[model samples]
Target: MKKLHHIYIISAFLLSSCSPKISSLITKDYQSLKYDEKVVVLGLNEQQPANAEVLGVVKVRDTGFSTKCNYEIALDKAKLEARKVGGNTIKITRHKKPDLWSTCHRLDATILKI
Candidate 1:
């Protein structure tokens, strides 16, 4: 029993240290953008383009066992989600850096078409 418990703990740790998680809520449907299409990323305080239209929201977070959710990676994932939802821009709504309880960056952004 002790050996099995140790094995489970090690397996969980190994898995958690492997991958981050990304999620999105798409409110409007549009033709998906091409892979090479550009998706502009805006900071939290940055103003969106005047012609912007809301598409949905996206979030990049660390699963309890996730280890690779750094700021750059999270931001990129958000942008990718935006493009998939046919958004031409993404405005960051929130950002949380790694802290005592978490070793990953978390991001939230609003997807838009401009």
Candidate 2:
């Protein structure tokens, strides 16, 4: 029974550690909102939403977790932050590469709404 418990605990830890996560740091302020499925991620030079308004900016942080985290995770986190800041769209404007192990990443983006 003790061996079984140990195995279970280790398994749980391993599983959790395998998942990727990213966080948002507010660079601008706006009315708080709940991110919706309608939110869109605009291209670097997407021209369609030229008239879209800027809500704010956010700095996305991700500690490139043990090969578990990827670029997509960081980008998604930035988009989510944009949505929460009362925007419907997100456009990453800058990127900071991580160290040799990719243990840290920073993404700067503009939050916009149509």
The top-ranked prediction according to lDDT is 1
lDDT of 2 by residue, 40-90 (tens): 776556554668777767775543344544567667777777767777778
Q: After superposition on all CA atoms, what RMSD does each candidate show versus the true structure? A: 3.9, 4.9
Clash list (residue pairs), candidate 2: none
* Clash total of candidate 1: 1
lDDT of each: 0.87, 0.67
Give candidate 1 misplaced runs (Cα > 4 Å): 1-17
User: What's the lDDT for candidate 2?
Assistant: 0.67
* Window of ten residues with lowest summed lDDT in model 2: 61-70
